[model samples]
Target: MDKKAAKILMSTFWGGGGWKSVSTPFSGEDFEYAKSQGVMFDPLTITHDEIVQRLHEIHQDDTLQERVVTAFLHSLSTKKVHLRSALSSWALTSQLPLHTYLERRAVHANTSACGDCNFLRLQSDQEYVDADLNVLNFERIKWGGVRHGWLLYCLMDLELLYKDTDAISEVTPEDQAILVSLLEAAQTGDPKDSARSLEKRWKGLFPSSKQERDALLEIWAAAGLLVPTDKPRRGKGGSGDFIFVATWQGDDGYNTDAALRYFAPYLPEIL
Candidate 1:
């Protein structure tokens, strides 16, 4: 492989920061072996040309290559990494134990679009969202591939259901109160009954009809802040029963910005 490829893969095994000289069970022999082969233990101290030479040496020695790659993978599996080295204001809202998750998970991002200019905004936004989505998918996959099936599902549970800054500001205080009430009613009471009550409560909030009240609720739901049960159950003789549940617990899942910020450290570096 080329030096660039070697460096990248080495980063994965040694971590983005490269190998440290800290004494550990795996460090002693592996460090000595790498140094003997002209490969620096600390990747940060090596030049690209040096990395290329080391990779060439490994290529000619089958046993050495196998040993090195195996040792590297083992070290990576047990080492530590951070999802975010620097915290931002937005990250304060993350409910996930991000650091713990990072320790056990291998996070990667698609860097193909990093410097694209043709459709920069759309591409970058989509990539960012996809990267976060990939993290969630990775957790689920590791937990056996069921939807929300990860044992540590909380790691993927970001508190961003209503964290849209624009949505918050546009939704007035009076409307916010109604939304919260509706959310509680949906989660705790009968869905149909709550709908009626909400309509009644809507009378003074604004002179609006039941349909208008429902429309307002739909608006918030469409804004990704709420989720209503898609399946309707038959109740009694023929009444359709529906349930509404807040997409988030409290203000959770509202801050997409924080989610990205917290996950940035785990992403791939474009060089």
Candidate 2:
């Protein structure tokens, strides 16, 4: 394995900045600027086949990450199971209350150890479910398995962007539709359209609340599906960079202008 390339790829794969327990070796901030522009880990020293092989080896084990990827792919292929519903089914299969299952997988406070009996605990299954869903909305994972679905989604996009193989057979039609819509919208007149304007144009696709629509846009931006026109703007109130929006600051931050354009390179050939 090219350790350097692997580190860069991992950093790009796990969006957001600062340190994360899962994204070790490279601080999550290490590739933040490159990540904002749809930059992927493409090392000159490695071949695409080699990279794909390494990815396969890394995921060969039947870890929870792999399971989540499998389940997500299944959901996409069948079009019958929602991602959240699949997660709920997995929780049910654990034969434990969702809270207990999650708590057991949680890292104990003040220590790197996970599944510690002394860790802060949620009172009920619904509490854990609610909490997990909340963070999952941010497309960030904690306690390993909590947000693996979105993690898998990002990984799939990364693989599709670089690898030549048809390895990832399942493509979410909803996501593809959004991507196609954005591409068409960007090509209409102004190529460098802001996130807010694009969101408004795509509003009908996201039939839910404004919050959900905004969240999806942010997630797509973070995943490199949408490229920002400029480097991430520093927040006025010391709130960190604006591209990979780490917080919900309404429209004043990343969503204010049409700063993002369609990342053409990321549009899958399969489309």
Candidate 3:
């Protein structure tokens, strides 16, 4: 594992900046709810670096390692990493067993972890789904690259697999219609068309409240499916928004074949 590459990928995968945890101080009702879950949760400032660092600490007791890895996986399942966009990075230190899990779960489709990125296959079991659960095709998912000693996703693009973390956990058929419309418009019009305009035109698909819309859009941006374009104004501030761009055939690098093979099924409707 390339430590240098790992750091770079971590920085990007975590969405830039250093590992900084912001505390979410639970209050009255929230605190009570947390206790019900068996943890007196006082969310603290914990960075990804800290988590990865703990993964490397080889103590005399292997129990500590197990606990750390377990906690890390739990975090992955529950917490939303910022800017976790279509691109992601994974560390390959001796202590972390994630590589083994990825290897075991990888759906090999005549691919390798060479060149720019590495790819993997995920299980379609709905009950035990991860962030990439909605993407039913194994070939569509590809990741590769070794920066320094760390494993990073390279030459890959985004595809809508998960609905994102929010109160709206599932993508209804209506939501699929919205996505289909967006994709159709993107394919025919100028590439520079404003996504904000599209949203405004399809206002009914989003929450009526501005605050809710902003929040939802932020989450969508982080998911890597939307690409933001800058629409410059005359001696004024720039405007525009990210649109749905990454599809089954958009990515041209390491996983083109896989993307082509699998992304086709999602056309005209999002599952």
Q: Which stretches of candidate 2 lie over 4 Å from their true place?
A: 1-175, 186-193, 230-271
lDDT of each: 0.27, 0.34, 0.29
Lowest lDDT sum, 10 consecutive residues, model 1, at 80-89
Tens-digit lDDT string for candidate 2 (1-271)? 2234334544444557643444222335544543343333212243223332334543444453334333333332333222322332222222222222233544443321223212321112211111222122123211112322232222333333233222234546664554455445543234333555555666665343454445444444443334433444333432232333332222332321222322223345533
lDDT for residue 129 in candidate 3, whole number 0-100 = 14
Give the runs in model 1 whose Cα sits over 4 Å from its true position: 1-179, 191-197, 224-226, 229-232, 235-271
Error of 1 at 74 (Å): 55
RMSD of 1: 23.7
lDDT of 1 at 158: 18
Top model number, TM-score: 3
Candidate 2 TM-score to native: 0.30
How far out, in Å, is residue 93 in model 3? 16
TM-score of each: 0.21, 0.30, 0.33
Which is superior by TM-score, 2 or 3? 3
Instruction: Give the C-alpha lDDT of model 1.
Output: 0.27
lDDT tens readout by residue for model 1, 47-164: 2223223323333533432232222122222211111100111111122221221122222323213222111110111111112232332221122112221111222221111121
RMSD of each: 23.7, 19.3, 16.3
Candidate 3 deviant stretches above 4 angstroms? 1-30, 34-40, 52-172, 185-193, 206-208, 228-237, 240-264, 269-271
